[model samples]
Target: MNPLEAQLDYAFADTLPDIGHTLDVAPGVRWLRMGLPFALNHINLWLLKDSIDTPDGVQKGWTIIDCGIANEATRSAWENIFATQLEGLPVLRVLVTHCHPDHIGSADWICQRWQAPLWMSTGEYFSARMMSAGLPGADGSAMLPHFEMHGMRDPEIIAKVSQRKSYYPDMVPAVPHAYHRLADGQRLRIGTHEWRVITGFGHAPEHVALYCADLEVLIAGDMVLPRISTNVSVFAIEPESNPVQQYLDSLEKYRNLPINTLVLPSHGKPFRGLHTRIEQLNTHHQDRLAEVVTACATPRSASDIVPIMFPRALDAHQMTFALGEALAHLHKLWFDGVLTRRLDADKIYRFQTHSAY
Candidate 1:
């Protein structure tokens, strides 16, 4: 077999987990994978069998994480599976890694059902509510001026900027009025096992990575993954943010985690060798940054540089996301002093070297 195929086989053999066909991980955790009407296809929900001692024969259940998009099918799956598979175990708590819909969609439903507390980083909790509430301050609306200023003139693109704002509602079964905020260094107990929360920035507001030192297992959420690179797009709320820089800073926090920890990711199969995958992700971005630098020699608009970086092309809907990703990298370079941006006569923004600065 080719080298890439061989490496994948090894990663899966040594690191990939076989949760189930519908579920992407393993069976011990009582995982349930649910479909979402998005390009990414699915999101996973994990139910850790709570081994906590109880007097009433009440089995305790705690969710390892949340699935993003919520719908009748997803909710139905939870009802059918939780009742049968869990044997009526009470959902003790819901732990969310971040504010993304696929990860936090069913949070309110589960929390409300069992009257359990929802736990997430303070930043993500607030952000999730904003997106879930269908408010004007949501990320897409916050991004309008940034795109308008950058020359995204297609009327459909503008309309989609509005439509994309509410994409999370499908997954947001309901919004939680309050949540128990998580922070770095906090310990989360699931029955007898405890997972330490690790915080990171850039990908989302205060993304959490739960690490169980005893079990050598980690619920990585979307902070780190085996296959596709996590989306680190710059949003309208922070128009000039150096998202790439923030994402790189977050990577340093994961480097010291035990390399052999079994990683339970949000999108891909669970695996070990967390550190090796971390290094690969880091290298991939560094290479991309280098390419962006090379492309900026003659000063180009963010839209122009997008095709050069992401040449495969995408659907109209996907293009909006792609443009945002491309802009994020340029913003990072601009803030890092490697590139400088200025508005032209038509208010179109362009970036080039900032040697004078």
Candidate 2:
């Protein structure tokens, strides 16, 4: 654990659920880990013991929180989970937190396999469908031009990024044609407890985090992570979006939760420090924004700011997010009037301190 992580209480510090298995984290909630093909090598999924009234009477089963990417390895892992872990009860419902591939990639498959209904926020559901279908603005094709406009001009890097047109579709080949919508503040009864939906923005369209007061546990999807700060990016579809501001504002929604709530995040170990983690996240962004403002004393493009923010060698996949995050900070500063933006002679956007010129 790093210095920052030492400040929080990790409920499961000495144990981790192996792939295809689960460990109980809270009352009626179990934790599962899935592998991802990225620097962030894993995503945490949850299984909630649940039952619902049906025509046959009370149907008992489990509700799935997020699905791993649609790949053979992930599918095989799910197969193992189904055979051994589910205790013979079928999955009751599939609820995705957002449209991200790791969260919803295998949603259709899982739903189809168990004949369960898919549940997600309207924005996330539609965004998943659009991106899965490789629609104009949401597809990987738009990323190159968007990054280029923000001044990503490296030919080798550009070549790698241009080849990612099939990125989303490759992982998430399809989405369920229908879904049950999740909304902010809506109460959902999964098993013995009721969880309130807490929608957050900037990370994804409408990310839903679940809070169960009875259990004193918060399923903080990607809203408040323990290890790394959640990625708040200005993607191609929302060019002028100030997601940094949106994300910071969204953090305020969690202040009402109890301080010692056990937070089961989508990444990192389960920890008890809701307010502490939120403060860490806020301070993380504030520090990043300060660095950006300092760097913008001279004109800088999103690409120019990427190195200052990331300060490491980036692969093609990481570069996309890095550039987007750089632009997100710039857009936030621009929106706050701390910086000014202009299109340079090369048709690339650049930002500088408002008082620079």
Candidate 3:
């Protein structure tokens, strides 16, 4: 539908992994897909062949990357894969791409079963724990004020937003206590190939995407998605954070990889043309920024800009993320000095283009 769509081609656009089945994508790397109850119905996880030590000797196993959410159906699917695939080998290690529930939900169960430790970026590890820990001041406490300040005055919608604070535990009830932290450019060997950690930001703090230059493959977590743009938002937790800039910088990081590299995104089918996708994502936000600046002719709050940017019917849940993203775009404009923000008479924040900048 856009320039990037015309520029990039899906290597196997017609192919998709069946539920509970492993599709051989590359040497020693198997692609697995799982179901989710979201509009984005499914997520793709990876199973990398590996060998690990036991009491007697080394045995073949797997390293699961990006576990699916915690649920009975997902649990059943994993059970089926363990039985059908892996040839009776155990899961040697659990690697998480990020802290979102869809990506790390089953980590606790899988790790406990195989006695494997979670390998995740330091930020993602703690973010997942703190987010799902059901802490007193952690989850929903900040949303009330943030939404209220953003001009969400409807009592019913405000009530729904208020209830989201306690909703994390059901999605991700528990996480393991210990994990091995991954760092940028850290080379890790799996099976026969070496994967270097590529740290990305904005979408999630310190999100890690794995790159195997030897195979020309990149397990682009949420960084280089093929179809839907990753959500880059300014949550109530960090209302002033300039995530849009961080997201742009993160896309720039991916530009250094080969354009024709095979990209295995967490969502969507595997595809090539990383450069084209990067261009699309960058231009997507830049266009959004321009639209936002134009809209600021009449000092607009985040809620005021959501319809301008998204222009769709949003449910209560969708509205929450939309507001956060709208504010994120505004924060980037303010951060770059393209716009100025101030409190209005109603004690709501609004942005307007500065004459000089």
Candidate maximizing lDDT: 2
Report the C-alpha lDDT of model 1 over 177-267, residue by residue, as the tens digit: 8888899999877767787989988889899988877777777788877677888887777677777778889888877877677777777
Considering only N, C-alpha and C atoms within 3 Å, which residue pairs clash in candidate 3? 140-165
The C-alpha RMSD of each candidate to the native structure, in angstroms, is 3.1, 1.0, 1.4
lDDT of 2 by residue, 1-357 (tens): 789999999998869999999999987899999999999999999999999999989999999999989999899999998898899999999999999999999999999999999999999999999999999988898988989999999999999988888899999999999999999999999999999999999999999999999999999999999999999999889899999999999999999999889999899999999898889999999999999999999999999999999999998889889999999999999999999999999989999999843
Off by over 4 Å in 2: none
Clash count, one per candidate: 12, 0, 1
- Higher-ranked by TM-score: 1 or 2: 2
Best-fitting candidate, scored by TM-score? 2
Which has the better lDDT: candidate 1, or candidate 3?
A: 3
Give the distance in Å from residue 67's predicted Cα in candidate 3 to where it truly belongs.
Answer: 0.9
Q: Rate residue 262 of model 2 by lDDT.
A: 96
Task: Write one digit per residue (lDDT tens) for candidate 3, span 209-301.
Answer: 999999999999988888888999988777789999998988887777876799999988899889988888888999999999999987899
**24 in model 2: Cα distance from truth in Å?**
0.5
Once superposed on the true structure, which residue ranges of model 3 sit more than 4 Å away at CA?
1-3, 53-55
lDDT of 3: 0.88
In candidate 2 the C-alpha lDDT for residue 103 amounts to 94
